[model samples]
Target: MSTKDVMIWRSNRAGTHYVADTVVMEEPLEIRIRFQDSDGKWVERPLSITMRTPGDDQALAVGFMFTEGMLLKNQLDKVTIGLENTVTVHFKPDVRPELEKLQRNFYATSSCGVCGKSSLDSLGYTYETLHLAENLSPLSPELIGSLPQKLTEYQSIFDETGGIHAAGLFDWEGNLILSAEDVGRHNAVDKIAGKALMQQSLPFNQHILMLSGRACFELLHKALALNIPVVVAVGAPSSLAIETAERFGQTLIGFARDGRFNVYSGIHRVDALVLPKK
Candidate 1:
């Protein structure tokens, strides 16, 4: 990663300003993918490109695959991403389960799926519901109150650009466990998931996952896939995310700011004496 110099400006209370020097962060290089359905055979077709920060492209690819429901964990043979704008994910043969669902209109985009799926109902998937450990205690108000500050403390890139989204994991005791930042909020979640998967600390049912933005259906889908018992967001949640959370018995919190928050579902996880208004 090389550094580039840029001009900066600063002003004081007296409306006095100065031109200074600064180093700007580089954009992430996006690796766009395309698929070719040659007769009955599916081939990897390279289509387009974009510029990104150039790290964790593999995780981004995997996350994209999972979100699109094109490849599950057991269905993938391997995912090999190259240094350049190329990524190849090999799937096991004779697994054309949803070939029709794989429409030709599937075009990869640089933005994460805020409008991910066609219908809200399509976002809901039957997930394995995990019971929390009996020994695991509920999250206290004090712990919840300090989360935003702690998340900001760990956000290196956000402090640098204020243009990135973040996702962080914390223990029941509110200890800052792990954090990841990306231009896309979903990518941030995927990076955190990829890191936890690499460390073999998944099935984070006892832990809390927090997002820097509003809770969307895609985030809920990923949380259900990971079997995370609780998800908190700094902003409001989508109606579909709330529905999925309730259906899966996962706790959902939103509008968490300035020492107040709202719990959308599974209120049992938070140990406050008074619950939020519906």
Candidate 2:
């Protein structure tokens, strides 16, 4: 369901031909929350509507709530996937969410998640600083370089549509633990985080996050929310992304491809001995 076929006219130097083409699917998914209000009545409210590819909707909802600091794993009762592109998260009866504090207008596009924010202050969500063990083994540059190829093997949707973003989680040894894809880069990361949350795996402190596109501030912010210590991207990182990583002790690497990568922060996590010789 992640890809759809449509007829189009393809033109090349040889000639123009009518053919069926595949494209990544984009659709609106409404995320809702169900909890007991102060008056002891059950209340269900729309939280956010995001444009994303049509798989992993439940994880997206859970991840969104976790990153937004609205829902904790212990408070989650169950998730219900309804028709018409809607997902509802039911919380424990005692759990009351402070919906007023969330300044988002509840709409997010595939390109940007923060576009619906009502103020700049809401952008600064509290994040924990990462602290790696002194005895932890540093990741080698060769292992980092090999991640992109490994990630591609998991991107079944991208191979058909050629238009999707992916977020992959890898261990120190460079084995992919999980990966998710969506039209929005942030949603992809959210899906991965949501999956981990459902599996009772929070604080990805021992893993590396790999991005299929440029590392933006929002993506880094989500990574921080999940306590992922290292982030690698096939593209470049934004100025704010680098600042955030440097500020929070997370390692940020960009341009990771073809047996090379550039580490922007937390250089100590990457072994210096294996760096490509000039």
Candidate 3:
């Protein structure tokens, strides 16, 4: 395994230098894809490579393809990871997408991506009519507030590296159902989604998704694919993520800290209970 220990310097009133030991971040690995064309020809294409935790590389690639409109569930044949930081995704021979212009860059940092929308109009262009259950109930405040501490208990990997982002799944009662941590927030969510898919427990609507980072379009897309109706994040939701949630009728909660949160869209699912005038 490739790992490193790094030191940091923090300037405070107490001191100007602080030796904080942390795991070194693995640089982004390039993900190249190859598939058979319609004319019985094999074509190799270079896809977007990202800075990831390296644990769930296959799922991360699949999720990336799914979100970027380059892949459909049934069209994929298999994903193979080779030696020395390389992944190849193969598709069925007859599978063809209308990707006329493959627009991308070399590197995708944790904070951004190449293909995802940067504007409302771009978001609308990529938005798919999500499938969701309409009559879902709201999570109680008690249930909602207890998530962070519960999440803390399941973070074994984070305990080891302190260099990962986590995504946790919880039931209506705030029980820590499942959790995963990765260097990339999206990768963690994709791992959760891919596991659910493999178990045939997908369309993850009945549970709440809590992210360690701010909500983004890719996260919303993953939730939508699983038919997840409730998504909570410890950070904020971007404008695109908010729009996606509103378009799909999924509840979007962000700034989830210290028992208080903001609902950007689909607030009805939260079931706001107002007090009577005393």
Candidates in order, TM-scores: namely 0.75, 0.93, 0.80
Worst 10 residues of 2 by lDDT: 125-134
Which candidate leads the pack in lDDT? 2
Task: Give the alpha carbon lDDT tens digit for every residue of 21-61 in model 1.
Answer: 43323454443333334455766543223333445656665
Deviation of model 3 at 276, angstroms: 8.3
In candidate 2, stretches whose alpha carbon ends up further than 4 angstroms from where it belongs are 116-135, 274-278
**Each prediction's Cα lDDT score?**
0.67, 0.86, 0.72
In angstroms, give how far residue 155 of model 2 lies from its true place: 0.6
Off by over 4 Å in 3: 6-20, 101-106, 114-116, 124-128, 171-178, 197-200, 275-278
Please give the lDDT score for candidate 1: 0.67
Q: Determine which window of 10 residues in candidate 1 has minimal summed lDDT.
A: 45-54
Taking every candidate in turn, the Cα RMSD to the unseen true structure, in Å, is 4.4, 2.6, 3.7
Query: What is candidate 3's local distance difference test score?
Result: 0.72
Displacement of the residue 113 alpha carbon in candidate 2, Å: 1.7
